[model samples]
Structures are given as C-alpha cells and as structure tokens.
Target chain A: MDADVEAARPWVAEASPTFITLIDQNHLLSSLYNMVNVPQAVWIDEQGRVVRPTETGGSIDILREFDPEAGAFKPEAMARAGAAKALYMEAVEDWARNGADSRFAYDPDAARQRVSRQTPETMLAHAKFQLGRHLASLGRVVEAEALFTECRELHPDSWNIFRETTEKMDTGIAAGEAFWGKVMGLGEKQYYASIDMDGMP
Target chain B: MTIVLTETSNSECVAAPSTTDLWLDADAVTAATGWTLKPEGFCKDDICVPTPADAENYVADGKVNVASFWRLMDRPAAASKDGDVWFLGEGATERNDALLSLEAPDFTLPDFSGKLHSLTDFRRQRVLLITWASW
Candidate 1:
C-alpha cells in the first residue's frame, strides 16, 4: 500500500502478475490488516472469513541469497530463509488447490485470535499511522510528520511506518544512511522476525 | 476523573470516562488520543515520551486526565467552558476499531492509469494483496 504508485508501476508491470495489483495510496491495508511490512500475506477462505493473519511472505530472502556479499546475513540464515520461502510457496499452492480443506487453513476463530493479540502500544502505533496517513492525504505534511514520528517512536520495528513516513516527507531518510543505520542499530539478527511454518500443510 | 474528551472537529462524541474521577481511564485516554500507555512512556513505537514524575497525581481510579497530562508535556488541547469536555486533535479510534476486528477494511485506490478498484471487488477470491513501494 505504497503512496508512490508511480515508482512501483515498473516493477509490477515487469513481473507481469496475473493477480490483483491494486494501489493503496492511503495505506488502509496496513492500517486495517496489521501489515507492518511489505509482502505480508494473509489467507481467507471462499466464505470471506480470514483464515490466516498477516505473515512474512519471505520473497525478500530469495534476493538476500544472491547478495550474500553484503555481509549482513550469514549463509546459514540465507539457507533458512530459502527453506522458509519454499515452505510458504508450497502452502500457498496447497491452499489454492484444496481451498478450505487445506491443512494450512486455520479456522476463522483461530485466525482472528492470532491477529487479536496486539499490544496496546502496537494499537497506538497503528492509530498514529492512520492519522498520519490522513494528514498526509490532506497535504498537512508538517502535522503528518509529527504523527508519523510518533508512530515511529511507538513502533520502531514497523518498516511500513518508517518507509511510508520518510517517503511522504521526501526526507530521503530511506536513501541508505539513516535507515540502514537504524537497522544496524537494531542488529542484523533483528531484521525480520522468523516465521514458524511448521504446522502449515 | 470524569473528564470528557471532545474532538475539536466533532464535539458530539465526547469521550467520557468510564470510571468516576477527573482522570480518564487508560482506555478513554487511548480513545481520546491515539496513544496507549507503555512501560517506556505514553508510547506509539520505538519512540517514547517519558511520563512526568507527578503524572500519578493526574491519574486516579485507573484513569488519567490526559488534558492535564498534555499540559505537563506543554502540548495543545482545548477545554470547554465548563471544563468537563477537553478537545484533542485528530485520532484514529475508528481505524483501530476496524483493525481489531481483523476484517480487511474496504478501500478504493486507482491503479497507475487511475482506474479505481475496491478491496471488495476481490471478495470470494484468494487475494495475495501485497504492498510495494517504488521508494
């Protein structure tokens, strides 16, 4: 749900995806579905019940494998990431073919429960981010920045908040220095939270 | 205490303290301000503005007088003449409510060509909705 639809167009067009590639300039997707980072996928059944909450898609790890020389990730971590991606893809295919019968599909109640464990702080971050998005939409850039900063302060681990906030301000904070520095401060091990796909069919 | 928080824009939905006191409940404070109390402070993310030492005086019966708290921070908030309703700036209670339900809130946004599409359009289909940015 990026604001820079123009920038994302070339990549989406190049991929030639058959699926829906919609824009969310206001980032309602993030605000609504707890999508704190890109490529976080959720599963829903034909009945429109959410069967899975937002999860790391792991596509980024495929790219990480090629850039091992970047020195941020170890070869072991890359392999773990690759295995995770393969497992995720397999689960997606299973769900696609098996529908609600898929072993990967959780019951609606289970999925809802999983998604409901948000801390009050996280909820506040989500609220602040939505307000920031609203202000940004209205061209209240300065006010939006204050809210965005508050969001960032509230949820430092949320890449969606940081990226969207910086991009809106044209702060160039994501231009490799400030962002990377923050990441480095957080440590490479803390980059992406590991997902447990062990029970997925 | 039973301080009512009224948004300057929409004064009708005055945030009333569920508990009696001049202090607003943490929940009420959260509703009034898009802020939840955390160990670090009244936090939103990685950043936290520390709570002042005397903040407890402003809180009573598990509620906080956020207007008083805002004053401690020197932030701006409007108070009504009767001093019962305090007006805070914009908040995201509605959005947070939508999110807590885990139901994908319907939204419409244009593609590169400006053709608008709603999330409801993909109902009954397995959607791989991904968020990507050019930046």
Candidate 2:
C-alpha cells in the first residue's frame, strides 16, 4: 500500500486495466497481512479466503546487478525482469481459470502455514509509522523523522514502513543507497521469498 | 494528552493507559480502544473479558486510563514515551485465528475516483489481489 495515491495514479492510468484500483495511504494491508514489501500478491478465493499468501508478483531482485554508476541495467537483468511478469501472471491465470482446484492454489493448511503473524513490535511499528506520516503531513518533519526511526528500528524487516520517506513510494521502485544496501545485504536470501510455483525463473 | 492511532485516522485521546498494565473501563476507553466497559466486563462483539478487580481507575478528571486495556485483554499495545499515542493491535490469538481459518483479512480502500471497495465485493469470484506501489 502507498501513502502517495496521487503519485501512483499515473501508473494506474498507464496500465489501463479493467480491474479496480484502490489506494491505501495508511499501509493497512501490510499491517493486516504482514506484508513486508511491495509488488506482492495475495490470492483470495471467492469466499474472501486467502488461498495463497504473499508472492513476489514476478519481481525478482533485478536491480542488484545494475551499475548505478553507469545508469544502465545489465541486458541479462532486463530480460529476466521482462519475463518476471509472465511467471506470476501464469500462476494467476491458472487460479482464475481453475479456482480452488488450480494446481497453484494452496490447500487450507498449506495456506495457513504461510501467513505470518503480526508481532507486538510490528504492531507498534505500524502505529509509529502511521503517526510519523501524520506528523509529516502536519509539517512536523523532525518529529516525524524520530518516529520513523523508531518504527524502522522496531520492524527492520518492513521495507514498506522503512521506505515511506524515500522516493515516490507509490511507484514500488525504491532507489538510492538505503534500498540498494538492503538488497545487496540480502546475499543468500531471495529478495521476495521465491514463489513456490515451479518454473520460477 | 493521549493520541490514538487507528488504521484510518488519528485523534487526540482524553485518557492515557497507566504503566501498571491494568486496563480500566471508561467512556474514553472505548472511544480510543473500542472495548466497551459493561457490568459483565469489557466486551467487543461476543467476546468479553472480565475487568480486573484492582482496576478501579476508570476515569480521572476528564482522562480515562485506556491504553493498557488491550494488553489486559491479551493483546499488545505501544505508546509514546509520555504514554500518549496508544497503538492498539489485535492479539496473536485473534490474528492467528484468522490465519488458521485462511480468511483473507477484509479491507475497504478507495479507488482513484474515490469510490470505496471492499475485498468482499468480489466474493464468490476468484480474485488476484495485487499490491503495488506507485513509487
């Protein structure tokens, strides 16, 4: 979810999709779902049940190879990034067409296992982040910074809360040292837990 | 001066929860934390928790000791250093139950045009809810 709905609007318009697009400036979904990053997808069945928990929505950590000094993406990374969408979309289509019976759909137990719980610290982080945004909106920049710092400390895994004051968050693309540093630091870990589906590139 | 931060809004609260961790029942308590103080105890929907006998301070002057109520109910909460800005969160039991049930947490958000839509609006239909940032 994004605080800057207006900044994200142009992208929604560009997509020109038939699906409904909603805005969440408060990052309520992240708080509710325990989502740590953006560009994640949740598969919900007809009865408002989560059939599949968060997935990377086809975004791999492609920018890791990007030489920012050169201001260009390696061709290999670009190609892989281009194909990322189809990998996730194929899974979506399978579920859409097959519903609960889809091979991609998770069983109740499997699905439940994947859902992460909101810890006390995380819940507090949500409050601090929300308050930080509120304070920032009120022109209390220094106070907002203090709150943001505390919240980020409390929930270091939450890139959503950590990236609030960064580049237009609505874009889902984070730039600069802070974002890249985290990415690079994730040496052995998958940027987004690899979607369990087979044929994941 | 307590400030309650909910998912949707932030407002000043008349009550700040005391540090002893005993949550009381008072008018401002429910206003900020949503648990109503009843003769039976603090109740939300069908769930009611018996108020501690020692929790006598419901309201002091215009302030209600409302912050620690969530902790008393087995939930967790956080506050600013001065005890202002209570952030109440769903307890692990409640949150874990939803996960155990596999129920997608329902949310209502507004479209670009300002029309509100809930996740349940697509009930009975397979929906791929994708969260993206405009950043």
The collision pairs in model 2 are A46-B124, A169-B135, A170-B133, A170-B134, A170-B135, A171-B134, A171-B135, A172-B135
Report the poorest 10 consecutive residues by lDDT, candidate 1 chain A.
Answer: A59-68
For candidate 2, write residues A62-129 as lDDT tens digits: 75678767789888888877777787788788888899889989988898777777777787777677
All candidates' chain B TM-scores are 0.47, 0.74
**CA deviation > 4 Å runs, candidate 2:** A68-70, A167-173, B1-3, B8-13, B16-25, B57-64, B74-85
Which ranges in model 1 have alpha carbons more than 4 Å from their true place? A59-76, A116-140, A167-175, A187-189, A199-201, B1-104
- What DockQ, between 0 and 1, does each candidate earn? 0.20, 0.61
Clashes of each: 18, 8
Shift in Å, residue A15, candidate 1: 1.7
* Distance from true location, Cα of A90 in model 2, Å: 1.2
lDDT of 1 by residue, A87-130 (tens): 88898898889887887887666666566344445556664555
Output the lDDT of residue B61, model 2: 39
Predictions in order: chain A TM-score = 0.77, 0.88
